[model samples]
Target: MPTTLPVGDVTSNGRTWRQSYAEDFTKPAALGTVASVYPGMGLYDGFQDTSGLGTYAPAKVLSVADGNLDFDFHSEDGRPLVAAVMPDGYAPHTTARVSIRYKTTVTDGYKFVGMLWPSSDEWNDGEIDWPESLTLGASPRPASAIPGTYANRHVKYDRSVQVHAKTDTTEYHVATTEWDTGIVRFYWDGELVSCTTEAVPTKPMRVTLQGETWTDHGAVPTDASGTVSVDWISIWN
Candidate 1:
């Protein structure tokens, strides 16, 4: 199993990749507060409104221990407390490969997502989401948005290319996404599960791991809670 980033070149899908960034969370620490500046990796530790269903209070939801980064989600004051973490300093990539080893507890009304989001924060620019689940235990899927699809304050994309893998979030799995010039590929446990060119994003983007709650699907119960653990993450460009 890959517990850490490759030291040198890594070969995958007949392509050579050089590691550009990685995090194993070996350093144990507590995220201070919302928007607190984490020294290592320049990580933004704080609240985020990624899904608009909850608040991402990293100080309350995130922690590093025993070489793993954990996201603990629960309700506070009738509002769900979720988590999101984004790395800084590394320039967004136009073409890159990302691998993450993670697992999650099956919790109703919650979702986990690993995505490459447009650095410009423009919805029309494009986005790539892999190993994304609308609810825990459901099959994971890869979804992408084609550039210039934003209109009337809503985002749309080609759903024809979306595909899912028969895997559960309770078990640790290495999920990977390869974004090339005009195509994107999704892999689970090193097996290709989906490939799409229709909604492949062309603009530079950065990765974010998020724990989200649901509002439309169902209201998150006050007692709903779970933890998402990431053993490590690696990025190549």
Candidate 2:
């Protein structure tokens, strides 16, 4: 893969996109210290208290080597281990595009999610998840959620309009999400797989790459382990 970022502006769907952030992971480092490794990104570490799942131990679960950012997930003390990371400063964009070239080892009890999370940190605003799937036995899909009133309480309603990709996680693929006014599109290998106007987020959002146990789909086996490698990532606005 090319170690350098794409040189000029990228034109897609008649829109000119200027690259805002890019990472090739050519310099070897640990993602746990992302501030020093990649300057404009932050790592989610420490025991996760709210999610009721495994710990986010970046040092143990994430690294950079061989020109890729790698996520190594395993069971620790019967609890799942995982990592999450995102870019800082240049985020919370009302309209943006993100593309990630990545592949993974297909393990039974692990999953990955690439998402645009609301900058407001409120579920009521919106969320966009793309290239999300279990590490095994599933294809990548684009999903979205919006908050609404339920039983006199505000709750998120997952309006995941399924846009499936035929590719599996073991093969390298470029997953892209384009967010514009009143619309969101998901593409796999430059082919538009899904588009949705429902619950399109209008507020600024930030990109997050998260790897976690597939608890929502099934119970994680005690011996589950896997690796997810991101060859590179580019953001445009």
Candidate 3:
């Protein structure tokens, strides 16, 4: 996601939070964030690293029909690929919410959509990883790798509330992370899934959504490609 002001405004709790950035992928030119694609993994506020071992293809806006646009993230060589956007400003220390609606085509790879501190070296710094999963069940897998299970996490001060909850990934689901001074909560389809207060982030962070062919060791065998679709994303503070 781009680091700039959103194009619209949303009012919540008597306070108005602007739409720092949004993409339906209806028009590529209209996309506000930097795009992270193959060969080059830098853009859209994403980190740049070596390619092939585990890299991402650039995010594209596919047109399904007239006036209908959807954001697409796919990998050509079965490598990791991602399409992400960052919000314009720091989240309010008092309260804030970051939410997105998305779905995947296959269960062979890893897909993570959530929030994290932009500059933190470790993911445990004030992070909210909802709808985060390792579906393929790596060779030396974690207990959460069951077919019908999904891993959702909340991190603060390096401590995390990592839980495996049963869910269907083929269908679209709404995932959100809400936080304030007391605690951070994870939600799926409007229901609370997990909550933690240990390592809640205090600094500002950015939103990231990525789809990759991965495992505990390396890339796993799967289709030549996979995709993750985003219907919409919103933030309030």
> Which candidate comes out best when scored by TM-score?
1
lDDT of each: 0.78, 0.78, 0.46
The residue-by-residue lDDT of candidate 1 on 102-220, one tens digit each, is 88888887888888888898888898888898887677888888888899987777686577887788888899999888788889888888788888888889888867885468678
Cα RMSD for candidates in order: 2.4, 2.8, 8.5
lDDT of 3 by residue, 93-132 (tens): 3356666666665546454444544344344343555666
* CA displacement after TM-score superposition, residue 159 of candidate 3 (Å): 7.7
Better of 2 and 3 by lDDT: 2
Candidates in descending TM-score order: 1, 2, 3
Q: Estimate, for each residue in 186-209, the C-alpha lDDT of model 2 and write its tens digit.
A: 898888988887768888888999
Model 3 spans with C-alpha error above 4 angstroms: 1-52, 59-81, 87-95, 120-124, 136-160
- Candidate 1 residues lying further than 4 Å off, grouped into runs, are 1-4, 31-38, 41-51, 88-90
lDDT, candidate 3, residue 137? 23
The Cα error of candidate 2 at residue 187, in Å, is: 0.2
CA shift of 48, model 2, Å: 2.4
- Estimate the TM-score of every prediction: 0.90, 0.88, 0.62
